[model samples]
Target: MFSIVGGHPALDLANTVAPRPPGAVEEEYLPDPEALVRWARLAGVIEADEPAEPSAAALADVLALRALIDPVLAGQQLDVLLRRWAAAIERSRLIPGPHGSATLHLGTDPALVIGDRLANALIDLVRNADLSRLRTCPLADGGCGWLFLDRSRNNSRRWCSMDDCGTHAKSRRLTERRRSRR
Candidate 1:
């Protein structure tokens, strides 16, 4: 299952690769072209009515774009990400939006559309988003290393989801306290 906790399309795409505990086999939600299309629809990168099915090479490009995103979110390897952004921009067009706005129109090629959209999204995030608000779920806190924008008033968010990782961490702490009291 895909979780859209990243708060951005690019980050959401990066999270398609599920994070796992140590010794557990890594889970990839986007294992095939169909899966990529499904996720793109869910992430609002593509429309539900869009009849886009990426080819194997296109899928590979999407996955590669995702790989580049994680490092940029972590504040490393930025030049590599910028290069990909340039390529995506080269293949895209700036089109008019309603209310005097503009939108980046992706090419019709299903193979490159998803990657181009993701790259553009990533660049938008880098330019407009508060990089300081970017936070990764801490693995030591029973998190799956998913990234999220911490928009909390206090900016103290530490888990991807309180119902999931936060509960695991709380239960662990309670058990430890009980044992230590014995």
Candidate 2:
């Protein structure tokens, strides 16, 4: 299942690979080209009628792109990711839309179309999103393994959701505390 809590489609994609407990295999929601398309559709990045299947090369590119996104979200250097994103964006062309404003149009390549959409979302997030609100879920239960925009007034959100990671973490801590007292 895809985690859609990033508030941005790109961030959601970056979250596909989640942290795992020690000795546990890492969970990759986008394990292959078909999985990528399924996630893209689930995220509403592509329409149901549109093709979402990615080619092998495109799948590799998408995985590489996701790898670059992680560090950028963590406030790291942007050169590599920027260059990759630039190439993806280059695959698309901006043209006048029926509404009079420019619209990005992608070629028939399914993978290119998906990459372009994710690349645009990432660029927009970097340019317009509140960096201060970006946060990682801190639970040892691997949490939700997703990044989220903490729109809370205090910006103190620690888990992806109170019903999920938050509940798991609280229960874990309580269990730990009880064991310590015994």
| lDDT scores in order | 0.79, 0.75
How does each model score on TM-score? Answer: 0.83, 0.82
Let me know the TM-score candidate 2 reaches against the reference structure. 0.82
Best by lDDT: 1
- Give the C-alpha miss distance for residue 12 in model 1, angstroms: 1.2
Clashing pairs in model 1?
none
- Candidate 1: tens digits of C-alpha lDDT, residues 147-181: 78899999999887888778888999999999999
Q: Indicate the TM-score of model 1.
A: 0.83
Clash-forming residue pairs, model 2: none
Off by over 4 Å in 2: 20-25, 74-77, 98-100, 106-108, 139-145
Residue 121 displacement in candidate 2 (angstroms): 1.8
